[model samples]
Target: MEQIIANGLYLGAQYALIALGLTLIFSLMNVLNFAHGQMYVFGGFVTYTVVVQLGLPFVVGLFASALALAVMGAAIEKFLFAPVVRRSKRDESTMLLAAGVAFFLDAVILLFFGEKQRGVPKVVNGVFNWDMRIIMPYDRILIGVLAVLLIVAFIVFMNYSRSGRAMRALAQDRTAAQLMGVDVSRYSMLGFALGAMLAGLVGGLLVTITGVNLGMGGPTSIKAFLMIMIGGAGVISGAIAGGFILGMMESVGLTVLSAYGDITYLAIFASLMVFLAVRPQGLMGKPWG
Candidate 1:
């Protein structure tokens, strides 16, 4: 039980960060960024290259991943999404564009990084065992703590920073924010970049544990969608709640259903479907008109 709780908390922290990015983009532009998972994969590859191929420190690689993804995200917003949003008459076009970008990134990752799984050396060695009931690797503990710190930092920024406030205003009401002298376009791009940065950061952090591969993107995106769906679409708090809930469910299912093999995920999805049928708007979402 103790090990399960520890595992759930670790996974939840990382999952929450991933969901936060996706939710931010949705709240701001109403665009479901299918490329988000690709962005994460791209970040992982960048870190792997820096740390493994280029012999850089893990910290440097992590920052490089975040910065690279941030630039890519801002460019995508400026060049692809923003133009399509302005010129296209339907939201479907943006969705298609996002899908195209996801495919493009997948190709790019495959070409540059190859299909082989890649991982960084552990930043720390050894395990932390408490009463033989809670055994966790030190590296996982480090990553988990860092993930929590990043989440807290994100919360602080959203509440106190100028850019964060501007983005929040834009997300809350674009027309009203514009009327209040907020630069909608600028903030929108910034928000997208921030979202991508969070995804990249998590990708880098998890590379040591999960050993990223080209095929991980789609499944990661699906998990993220499940999280947002469970919590409430476009709600920040909802994303966090959904992530933790899903994490705990996964931990419990993995432990209790080990004899059943892959049925754990099937059970989880079935449960989620039932739950969503009862509350389609999610835990904190308002009913769609």
Candidate 2:
């Protein structure tokens, strides 16, 4: 049970990291970026190519993966999202555009990578043994530590940095932010890039733990969506809360009913429904005024 709880916390950390990025983008742009998952996949591929294929150092590969995805995120914001913002269309249009990008990217990846599950080489190796009875991978511990560091960095950036303040302003009210000379479009692009970079970092971390493949993106996106929904659309802290809760539920569910493992989704959906019934605006979300 202790080991299970540790594993759950590790998984929750990853989910929280991914969900944080998604939640930030959704809050600022009001768009569920379907292509975000592809960026995650791309990050893994970047690291794989750099370290595994090209024989580069792990840290180099990691940074390269993050930088590449950050550039892609910037491009996505500028070319795809910026046009939609310029047209001032409904929120649905942005979702549609994201879906279209998702489909296109998936097809491209399928054509190139085919269907293969490949694992990233572990950067750190060991096992933590407690009382000479329980053992767990040090890599998972590293993941949890990294997640905490990233979350702290995100919070600090959002609260202290100029660009972060602009992002917060835009998230609250775009028109008002623009009137205050915040350069809304620029800030939006920055937010998207930041979000994508975080996703890429998570992707790199995930590859070390779970391997890489094309199909993983879709399921990850679904999980991220659930996190966002359960966390509340616009709340940063909500993402972490929802992710930990969902991760614990999933881990506990799997342990208790390993044979009926597929029922986790039903449990998640029920929880969401219950949460909505009681707190329509989500745990941290502001009530409709």
Candidate 3:
């Protein structure tokens, strides 16, 4: 039971990281970025290339991946999303644009990497043992610690930084924020870049635990989308709450019923549907007035 709980927390941390990025983008842009999974895959590949291939340090690999994704995110905003926002059309166009980009990137990855599952060297090795039976990997512990630190840093950044405040203001009301002298485009790009960077971080951590491949992006994106929906769309706290909830549920389900893993996902979606029906705004999300 203790092991299950610990495992759940570890998985939940990753979910929260991914969902937080999704929520940030959705809150600011009112569009779901379908290409987010590609960012994760790309981040992992970049980290693998830098650390394993180039023999760079793990930290250097992470930084390189983050920087690469940040640039990609900024460029995407400038070229794709910016044009869509400028046009007078339904937000569906933005969704389509995002999907197109995701598809294109996925294809490119398949072309380049074929269909190989690649893994990264663990940043931390060995295990932690407690008392007589409880044991867990130090790497998982590291993931939890890093997740908490990143969450705290994100909160501080949003609350204390001027740019973060601007982002919040824009999320609340883009037109009002623009009138108040916020450079909407620049902030939009910033939000996207930040989200992408977070995704890259997730990718790096994930590669340590699981192998990465081209097809991994689609499932990851789906999981992220489910997390954002379950947590309540456009709510940061909701994302975090939703991630833990899903992670715990999954862990418990897996522990109790190993053969029925697929059923666990169904249960999760059912819960999400129920939540949407009852709260609509999400568990931690505020209802728009």
Candidate 4:
């Protein structure tokens, strides 16, 4: 039971990290990036390629993965999506554009990395036990700590920094922000890049505990999509809250109802159904005035 709780908390934190990036993208840009999970996988690949393949320091790969994705995100926004947004008559086209990119990227991943799962070398190893009852591994502890610190840092950035303020302003009211001299194109690109960087960092980090493979992007993207839906599409707080909630649900469901292992999805689906029926706006989505 104790281990279950610990695992659930860690999973919740990790999910929240991914959800945070996803929600930020939606909040900053009206486009829903269906290709985010690939970026996540790419991040791990970058780490694996660097640290494992090239024999560099793990930390270098850790940050390099983020930088690589950040650049890719900016390029995607600038060249791919922005061009479509400029000429298109509707925002709906963005979805198709994103979907197209996702499929293309997925194919690219398969071609380059193949279907094999690659394990990340542990950043740190060993386990810790508390009074012979509660036990925690160092790797899990590292993940949880890093996730929390990163999340806190992100929140601080969004709240206190100048660029962060600009993001918040845009998320709140794009027209007003633009009218006040905010550069829409620059910040929009930055928002997308930052979101991708977050996902990539998680990619590198997750590999410390789990193996990375090509198909990871799809399930991860699904969970993120579900997370934001539960939290409300454009609400950052909603994403965080929803992530933790789903994490606990998955943990408890798997632990207690192992026989009905599908309980995680079943519970999520049931909640989604109820939310759609009663309050489709999401837990933290603001009701329009």
Candidate 5:
């Protein structure tokens, strides 16, 4: 149980970061970015390239990943999503565009990063074993701590910073925000960029532990969607709650059901379905129209 809890907390911290990005984008633009997972993979590859291929420090690679993804996200919002949202009457148009962008990103990743799994050297050595009950890698501990710190920073920013306040305003009520003198376009783009940056940062951090692969994008995106749904689609706190909930479920299922083959996920999905049937709006979300 100690091991399970430790593993769950560690995984939850990182997973929450991923969900935060997705939820932020959804809250701001009402656009589900299918390409988010691809962006994460791209960040991992960027980090791998910088650290492994270029012999740069891990810190440099991490920042590079964040910066690159931020630029890409902002450009995508400016050129693709914004225009589509402006011109289209139906919401499905943005969804289709998101799907198309996901495919395009997949192709781009395959072409540039190839199909191999890429990993980095351990950022820290040794394991922390406490009373032979909880054993965790030092690198994992560091990653978890960093993830938590980043999350705290993000919360602070959203609650305190000018851009963050603007983004939150936009998310709450677009028309009201605009009427209050908020530049909707600029803030929307900024919010999207920040979300993408978080994804890239988490990817870079996790590369040392899970490695980077071209095929993980779809699964990652699916997991992100699940987190958002579990917590409530457009709520930040809900996203965090959903991420930790999923992480705990994953940890327990993986550990307890190790002897049961792949039934772990089957059980999980079934449970989630039942839960959603009971509370469709999630723990903190408003009911859908």
Candidate 6:
């Protein structure tokens, strides 16, 4: 039972990290970046290279991956995405643009890596046993701890930091924030860069916990999409709630229906559909003002 709980927490933490950035970006920019998951895959691959090929420590690999993706994200926002935003006739254009980016990045990764799973060395080896039973990997526990810390840090930064307040202001009213002389473009760039950093950090952690594969992007993206939808379309709290909810559901589903793990999503979505029918605005999300 303890092991099951631990597994659920671990999975929830992973989902939280995956969905957090998307939550922030969508809330702040109203841009649903479809390539978010691909950015994560890119981070995993970069982390693997930094650790395995460059003989760097895992910490260095993580930092390098985050930094690299932050720059890439900012560049994409500035060069590729901003232009489209300026000229787009409908909001869906950004979604399609993001899809194009996702496909392009996936193709590039496939061309180079050839669809092979890349293994990452454990940040920590061995398992810690509590009392007689309840065994779990130290690395996984460490990763979970970091994920929680990051989540908290993000919340704090958003609430207390100057830049954080600016972001919130922008999310609440873009035109008003712009009128107030907030650096609109800079914050958008900052938002993308920071969101990409979180995604990259999660990716590196994933590499440490599981392994990297080309196909990871699609599933991660789907999970992220459902998380936002379940939580609330643009609510960070909703994303967090939805992630843990989905994680626990998957954990229990795997335990009970071991052979039909995928059924968990069906159950989750069914529940979500029912909830949306009743509340339409999501768990933490407010109806539009």
Q: Provide the global lDDT of candidate 1 against the true structure.
A: 0.92
Worst 10-residue stretch by lDDT in candidate 1? Answer: 280-289
What's the residue-level lDDT of 144 in candidate 5? 97
- lDDT at position 158, candidate 4: 92
> After superposing candidate 4, which stretches have Cα over 4 Å from the reference?
none
Model 4 residue 138 CA deviation in Å: 0.6
Error of 1 at 201 (Å): 0.5
Error of 4 at 262 (Å): 3.3
Clashes of 6: 0
**What TM-score quantifies how close candidate 3 is to the native fold?**
0.95
TM-scores of the candidates are 0.98, 0.95, 0.95, 0.96, 0.98, 0.95
Runs off by more than 4 Å, candidate 6: 259-262
Error of 5 at 249 (Å): 0.4
lDDT of each: 0.92, 0.84, 0.85, 0.87, 0.93, 0.86
Candidate 2's C-alpha runs over 4 A off are 132-134, 259-261
lDDT-wise, the better of 1 and 4 is: 1
lDDT string, candidate 2, 1-289, tens digits = 8867877888888888888888888888887888878878878878887888899987887899789888888899899988886796476888889989888878877886676886777778998899765578888888789888888999999999999999999999889999999998888888999899988988888888887899888888988888777778778898998778778877888887678757877877887889889988777777740
Query: Where does candidate 2 clash, by residue pair?
Result: none
Candidates, ranked, lDDT? 5, 1, 4, 6, 3, 2
* Native-referenced Cα lDDT, model 3: 0.85
lDDT (Cα) of model 5:
0.93
Overlapping backbone residue pairs in candidate 3 total 0
lDDT (tens digit, per residue) of candidate 6 on 75-149: 988998788988988877898888998999899889976688896888898898997457888998999999999
The CA lDDT at 150 in model 1 is: 93
